[model samples]
Target: EAGVAQSPRYKIIEKRQSVAFWCNPISGHATLYWYQQILGQGPKLLIQFQNNGVVDDSQLPKDRFSAERLKGVDSTLKIQPAKLEDSAVYLCASSSVIGGEQFFGPGTRLTVL
Candidate 1:
């Protein structure tokens, strides 16, 4: 089975700038998630989607970050007016079902200047 896919393995942006990242989950998976991982901290769940519907987004910074999983397959995450604190790894993951182990993609590492 093919693994998850992500683009532009790294990104550099200035504070207040805007950026977006893309993700392609495993075929036939039903749950997808976006997580932010800082330099030393564990991955923090940002948003979750069960198919094209949002399941959880409590930790997503609505003021700056937004995401969507159209057609319940590929997804995109965007951040407008980025901040220095946003410098971190944006990881995309997917699972075959709820409560299942997730397969991760090589994240897009963002460096805010």
Candidate 2:
């Protein structure tokens, strides 16, 4: 069996530039999530989706960050005019169903200059 997928595992950009990350969750998974982990801190949930519908995004920076789960499988996260404080690990996670353990990907590290 295959595992989760994440793209552009590392990225470096100017503070005002833009960046995007992609993820593909495991098959048959019903819940998908995106998280951001600042250095020295634990992962913080940015958004969650269930079958192409957004379930949560209260913590997401709507002014600069946006994400979507398409077809309930593939997902994408984008940041425009990236800020220095936004440098962190962008993680994509998924679970089989309610109460299922979330499996995380390798994560995409963003460095802002």
Per-candidate TM equals 0.98, 0.96
lDDT of 2 by residue, 4-92 (tens): 78998999999999999999998999899999999999999999988899989999999999898777889999999899999999999
The digit string of per-residue lDDT tens for model 1 on 79-101 reads: 99999999999999999999999
Best by TM-score: 1
- Clashing pairs counted in every model: 0, 0
lDDT of 2 at 61: 91
Off by over 4 Å in 1: none
Candidate 2 ranges with C-alpha deviation above 4 Å: none
lDDT of each: 0.97, 0.92
TM-score of 2: 0.96
